[model samples]
Target: MRPLDLLLAVGVMLIWGYNFVIAKYGLAELPPLLFMALRFGLVALLLVPFVRMPRGRWRDVLILAVMLGLTHFSLMFVGLAHVDAAVAAIVIQVQVPASAFLAMVLFGDRIGWRRALGMAVAIGGVAILAGEPRHSSALWAIGLIVTAAIVWAGANIQMKRMTDLDPSTINGWMSLLAAPMLLCASLLIEDGQWQAVTRASGWAWMAVAFQAVIVVIFSYAIWYRLLRTYSVNQTMPYTLLVPVFGVLSGVLFLDEPASWSLLLGGIATLIGVGIIILRRPKAVEAQAQVT
Candidate 1:
């Protein structure tokens, strides 16, 4: 990767990593589904003018809504409600191996022996992390996170199928489709909608706005560019740092405890996934054509 691209990648990672802490703080004052609804609603409004239906392949667009926008965000928000964002960050990193393994089973994609071993180590680390959590709710939260990752992996495949559109166009349309589902879910599940809206503090509104504009709208443009320009496996490893930042932010801001198991499992996850990412195809060559 060029220095600029590398820096961009790291910057994206930091934004995502810090977001866990932000989401944790956001959740303190807002219900998970309600917060998600507002976040997507704002994103939809910002993006609506730019949004266009996916040309020639509407199925890919629908897939993106379900996998990338709806399923991923909803489960993740619910999961965040159950655990610290930092821990959620760490645990969610396993999606790399999950996608790889899913590819192997679903598409017969080859995972050379080394990658196979890495996958094993990563899975073991996740198991240890889940077991180490004292609260049963935390374990369930991990399940929710993994579910979100699975949906995200599916979305990645959908994105790969749509080679016709620019990243911004794709993201705008997907966000638009996803917004209503989230809003309806929130309305059905959450009580006192008008009161909740009125009672929400400025900080909560800021959090929702940041998530909508920064995290989903802006950051995702960068991310989708990366996805389109590089092979899925090639750019995925940078995501490991997300959990590291997540955990640190949690400790520093949320004052969440850092347990031995969390620390060990996190390290194991980073090391194992790092090996997989580094061993995969170089991204420099692929990014050149896109850039």
Candidate 2:
């Protein structure tokens, strides 16, 4: 990563980190599914004109949209409405381990003992965090977010199959496919969609715009550019900064308390994820062969 690219990576981290707080604000004013519908609908509307139709993988694209755009975001935003933003940020890191585990099961990807240990430590940390008395009421919400992470991991697996497609085009088509599906889900499962839209404040609308345009479109455009320019190992590590920024922003802006459990568990989880992510490829392959 060049110095400029590093700065861009950090900028994307910041945008994503603050997104939890932004989503919280938007959820305050609207139902979770409806808010998600608006976010994806706006992104689709803006990018569909410029992005070309995906070639010969419409089913995969729709599946990815359902897994990532509809299922993941709907559960996540609803969980955010019920839990603290800082906790949401920390808990969502489980996606890393979840993805690794899924690969092991689904594709026979072999992870070494060290990586296995990292997954255990990460799961343990999430368990400890959830067991905290302060967050007892949010256990269900935590489960929802963790399940969302699993869905996200599944989407990542789907993404690997679509590696030839441009990231922006994938996002654009996924959003286009997801918008109506999510809106229909909102109509069936949630009340007050129309009322929420009618009554949404300017700040809430701004939150939606920020999520749609900045977080999804702009940051992802730059992210794909960086991935093209740099090795995955060089750029992937910076993502650890997301939860750091998320927790800090929640504390600073949302006045969310960071308890001892949160700090310890979050640190453990991040460290574990870091180890798994930074491990050498040859080591992983060697372990797999031995196993």
Candidate 3:
């Protein structure tokens, strides 16, 4: 990658790293689904006009919205409400291997024994972190986060099928669809929606704005630009920084505890994720084989 693009990749990861903390702060004031509903609504209202429609790809985009915008964010924010952001970041790393494993099962993509071991090690780390919880509710919360990870992996799979569509187009239409879906979910299960909207502070709303603009629009724009230019292997390594920054931001900003189990489990998880992420793609492997 060029120096400027590398910097852009790093910037995206940084915002994502801090996003956990930012979202936690926001969720404290607003219901998780409602918070996401507002974020997507703003993104849709702002970007829908500037971007083209999916036209032929509505099914894929809508599935992505359900997987990522609805199920993943709903479970993630709800999980965030109960667990520490730092650990949540680490545990979510399970998605790295989950994606690989899903690819193997769904598309006959190769993971081999190396990546298989990587998956086990990653899950074991989550198990360790899962044990760190003092209460059963926290375990359930962790499960929710893991389930979110699986859903997110499914969303990635959906994205692979929509490669011809611009990221902006996919996200724009997704936002317009997802906002109402999230609002309905929030209305059905959550109370105090009016109270949250009225009572949320400026900082809380700022957090939502950051997510909508920085994380969604700017960062993902750069991310897709990078992916278009370079191979996945080149950019995947940068994501390792997310949990590092997540831990630091959570520790320094939120004063969340950094117990020994957290340290051990987080390290183990990152190691496993690195093993999976740093691997070359099968297509690249085939190219090399031909050479």
Q: What lDDT score goes with residue 87 in model 2?
A: 89
Deviation in Å, model 3, residue 191 alpha carbon: 0.5
Q: Write model 2 residue lDDT over 1-291, tens digit each, in one string.
A: 678888999999999899999988998999999999999999999998998975688998999988998899988988999988888998999999998888888877778899898898888888888999988888999999999998998888788778778877888999999999999999999998878899999989999999999999999888878777776677778889999899998999999998999899889988888877876355333332211
lDDT of 3 at 81: 87
| Cα lDDT, all candidates | 0.76, 0.87, 0.85
lDDT of 2 at 277: 81
lDDT of 1 by residue, 253-290 (tens): 88888898888888888777776665553432242224
lDDT by residue (139-217, candidate 3, tens digit) is 8889999999998888877776776777788888999999999999999999999999998999899988998998999
For residue 192, model 3's alpha carbon misses the true position, in angstroms, by 0.7
> Model 3 misses residue 103 by how many Å?
0.8
Q: Model 2 compared with the native: what TM-score?
A: 0.95
TM-score of 1: 0.88
Q: Work out the TM-score per prediction.
A: 0.88, 0.95, 0.95
Candidate 1, residue 228: lDDT: 63
Error of 3 at 270 (Å): 0.4
Q: Return the TM-score for candidate 3, rounded to 2 decimals.
A: 0.95
Q: Which ten residues in a row have the lowest lDDT in candidate 1?
A: 282-291
